[model samples]
Target: MDPLLLLFSLSAATCAYLLWFYLLARNLTGPKVWPVFGSLPYLFLNRKRMHDWIASNLCSTGGAATYQTCTIALPFLARRQGFYTVTCHPKNIEHVLRTRFDNYPKGPTWQTAFHDLLGQGIFNSDGDTWLIQRKTAALEFTTRTLRQAMARWVNRTIRTRLWVILDKAARDHTPVDLQDLLLRLTFDNICGLTFGKDPETLSPEMPENPFAIAFDTATEATLQRLIYPGFLWRLKKVLMIGSEDRLKKSLQIVENYMNEAIDARKEKPSDDLLSRFLKKRDMDGNLFPISVLQRIALNFVLAGRDTSSVALSWFFWLVMNHARVEEKILRELKTVLTESRGGEPKRWMEEPLTFDEAEKLTYLKAALAETLRLYPSVPEDFKYVITDDVLPDGTFVPAGSTVTYSIYSVGRMKAIWGEDCMEFRPERWLTAGGDRFEPPKDGYKFVAFNAGPRTCLGKDLAYLQMKSVASAVLLRYRLSTVPGHRVEQKMSLTLFMKNGLRVYLHPRTLA
Candidate 1:
């Protein structure tokens, strides 16, 4: 035989063998696998509506432990790499997030993705380092003085800063973008509470602020990483291309502002969260180092600002769509406030809403819960399998695979939430006994603030902040959606409104 003919024959045979192997493996895997692209084609078909696409697939493929795999071709590699993805199953989530948590650290992959923005903060760190930071944060967050101070600051921001902006928009008959306003308010409030310095984001003129600008840019760039993984970025970093330069610039802006704030706080020693974190001594009596302080400050900026703002923005949007629900919330707010005060127009914003006060507003809490159910700010979370384990439902997850829990999808699951799962009904959260609803387990179902050991410590503070702002604003102004304004979701680590939520605020007159 000719040498060229022999070579061609050999190549054809090898291709045939690999094709047969892939088809055989696909049959065994139980997930719908396309020939060469695997699941990528299907995913691309529904890329515009990714969450719904995945949810529908999960539903059809059977609930809980159903596994799906996707293959991506890489240059210099002989065979394609298989990546497995899964949906919400409490026990499976528990195994990944809590039970064998040590085995499944955030890993270097996530650290690289978030490092340019979050650095080595608790949100990205793992192992003993994460534990130390979490412990210190929890201690500071739950401290009486810090809690009291935060409450006061949140209430004051709601009353003075936030309301003033809304009032101006209402009076001038200018349509307000509630999403942008909420973001600004939360940024200002969190900055004040954490660093004892105001960014003045809610000012009348809305002056340009580099920190806020960079923060928004950083968030958008971080979301891009989800579509293209960080390893790809690391490769690009080698060549020094694409958004790498932009990301570096944003990080520098954030770091410069943080370092300045830290320096000022160190000199002044005020009673903000940063000051407390700086002065806080560990069990071994060592103060948090400057690097740790910077990490903590950046973590607070990410956590404290985005979560509350996103939640509040969604809550208001829900209220606008559901007027009857808004009526119920207003009724509940009135009853609670009236009972709290003896019909006196005293300083409502100066005092913190006590745990008892928060409890009394059952409908308000329910409304917020329903909002979170439908539009969780942190829509999805991923956990990589550390060890091979069988889930409660008896599905086996192999080691070195990533499992994603769709908090957004779980909230809308018919199996979990009944037939009306997709509806934004606040009444679903009201118990038959007329009390606020509670989850069966805090891990997967009600995972808006996450669950188990890594549950968000700022959950209570977030609720308080949202309630204060909602009550204060709704009592004074009636917000209606601006005509033909389409509100859509932007896919990011945080669920933000793609187009700002434009609304007309009509000031309510006291009867």
Candidate 2:
């Protein structure tokens, strides 16, 4: 009799607890929540289309402002019910990025996830560490010499390796993976600018550089840490198994390469970022330690390689799909070239577009911006809340909670951009005259380069590299997507094409 009564009491308590959980979960505006799993099941199910899923959730929450700021339940993975506030609203974005900038840092989870690969680098650190690196990097990015160095590297790669490979592919009528090509090209270019050493990953032979492979492997492994819970990855790391094991090996290769580069720079200084950092003194008038320099150099490489290459990959795919946009870009390029070189298309096409010429292609830049609007390289970013605060849309985020701003979702929100927000139209970025490029009035709306004080310092250099590459490729060759080749998005930290962009290149004739 006593045992039966105890069983009944326990069942009643469990039912009561479930009811309480349901009541609180039903009040949340985001994805569905189970008892123990919270929204983990939904997140897992929609993993491939995670960004679009978040955008759908935000859109369904009563127009834009009514529920633009939504929270996901991950009670098990995070502390205090594991609520993650995801926002796509411009006002909320402004609030989190600028208005409450100090209140949001990289947070422990972010820093810890990336610490192994990135160390205490600028991108992975917060407060004074990030500030010092930012101030130092800002000073360097502003120098005319850095831009010139970047241009030299980009142009040389295009003129020698990239063009050579593409020309051979065109002659052979072979389909090439354009995404891989761009990744290699940007890898080589960034490596040169970062350490004055070129991995030459974009050679005609298409060799794989150990450092590049290791860097990519480490990045992917690091992203896995963010996707899964911290404890699970930590256990794997301790056990020396799975992705963590691969990460360990990759880090070794990367460290070796970086150490070699650092040693080389010390022996004979160059104008690369590493050399500059070596010469510059910190606050105490002391040289940055070897570990700090290595991390800083790795951070630059990480930032420079994937973003522009991924953006260019999407830009090419978009232009291939939208012939009208491609034609407009070509027309703009031709006009600029005609003005610059008296219409010697063939002669100029032999070499990549110069920095001056690339800057003149306003329409092309607009197209690249439009591409980023549709497909940002870093689709979403996470920030840790330092204090309890309310977003512009009135959504409250408590301390220790995570806030994610979806760049992908922001570009698709009709309330922010117009009904035609989903469409790829560079004209939106131009004035009525269509001669000059004009960004949106509210800088927060187009945050492909991010907004506020932490905005990308490499914005100008990124544009220079993208414009040079895009103009050179479009002017020299007409790309056609291979039949039966599928283009799908890869669910990773960077927006990469899962199947890669496969296309055949045909020589362009200028009549």
Candidate 3:
């Protein structure tokens, strides 16, 4: 056969196969699907703008769409794979996340992608392994002693460490990366909580913590595995080349820190997570090995370190941009302070407010919730279907397919949040004809902390951290993004600001 003739023949066959699928699955509507390759090429081409692209398509498709990616099915190197459905529909989200939660575990595919970093921790594990970790962590988190410890830790850190940094930045008029600062602060806080010792990532000189740096690199590399085809990354790993090699090196750095903490706990046990985990044993009277300990430590750092910091960064950005929101928060703070001090605003301004006082700043809490709605810490998540399941909207997802729920896309769905969904309106979270905060009737609709059995155990702790920090900051300062500094989102496992939030802090004026 002539080369041109063969090329033309293959093109014609691809078109024919696509038309055949078009005839068969007419209801299947999403990105442009091709023959054997499915939608891989399109996804590859638009990878840079993936989150935005997915959100736009979901909005247009009435909050649900499927993306299918299969190899061209070549005998030598390629094989058939991938049936992915992404939904922002509240009903579908409820069904997947809550009602039929048992049918969707993180599954083998997710574990494969995150295994290097998360291993068999609570975030990555399923069944009995997850249950044991969950129970152990839950016991620790819900204790009143832990609550008192956290309150003391957070408030003391804010007054002594975080405030001093921002105060210097405000006085010196130096541009600071607020996100970077928060990252360090949270890193220190969570490390203290996890190991009963601070790594001092928040030192005035801001020295780079090797474990923190390596953990970040490892997580970023882990996310790339989800983007590239599994086989290619695995091949690269086997060869000890490229991102996989970097990932391996980074994981070693992270594990060293974990092991050091474990050693510290043994020599001098304290009331921290590591100490508690050391005392725990599973069903067979088998304690979790050091590897399991490492996984749990990594999970705590990932959950506690990044998520709250990133969220606070975004919240500050939103509050700065919307003066009304900021003013409202200030008003709420003033009211709380006045009530607490019995009308001594001057003295209240001078003294650092306690967590109990911060708790009454309802408007500030609502604003934080709204910020999360716009920018969830974990913007998108996927679960592998253990069995064939029907979503509430009647989407038929076959067994072995991965159904993803986009917390980012779902937040922007007008059908779920109404016509003004795109607007940065914290008022949506407030009560009708009143300024009081009101939560959504359907809990699954707002999944910042997730829903059902796997709902984040760290929810209260996160709030304690956020409320304590946010209230303290709002009472003391006014922040604005530095002029001409670019604020963009980074492509990662978590929703981190790409360049970080550069800002100049100004002390608030009060009469």
Please give, for residues 332-381, the per-residue lDDT of candidate 2 as tens digits.
Answer: 88888889888676777867888998888889989999999999999999
Against the hidden true structure, what lDDT does model 1 obtain?
0.74
Write model 1 residue lDDT over 1-511, tens digit each, in one string.
9999999999997788677756545543334565555566765566566666656766666455345565443222112124555666556676667777776677665666777777778898887778877898888788777777777777676666777787788889999888888888889888988899988887777778999998878877776665553466777667767766677788789889999999999899888889878877644578877777887788888888888899889999888879899888877766777788645535443354554576577788788988998889887777666677666667666666556677777776777777887888888777777566554444466789887678899887888778777777777778889999998887667888889899999987533
Q: Which candidate comes out best when scored by TM-score?
A: 2
The C-alpha RMSD in Å for every predicted model, in order, reads 3.1, 2.1, 3.0
Judged by whole-model lDDT over C-alpha atoms, candidate 3 comes out at 0.82
Model 1 TM-score relative to the real fold: 0.90
lDDT to native, each model: 0.74, 0.87, 0.82
The CA lDDT at 108 in model 2 is: 93
Q: After superposition, how far is residue 429 of candidate 1 from its true place, in Å?
A: 2.3
Candidates 2 and 3 compared: the better one by TM-score is 2
Writing each residue's lDDT as its tens digit, candidate 3 over 166-269 gives 89988999988989989998988888888887888886788998999998999998888887668788899999898899999999898888888999898999
What's the TM-score of each model vs. the native? Answer: 0.90, 0.96, 0.93
Regions of candidate 2 where Cα sits further than 4 Å from its true position: 1-9, 65-81
Ranking by lDDT: 2, 3, 1
What's the lDDT for residue 468 in model 2? 95
Off by over 4 Å in 3: 1-27, 63-80, 342-346, 349-351, 433-436
**Can you rank all candidates by TM-score, best first?**
2, 3, 1
Q: What is candidate 3's TM-score against the reference? A: 0.93
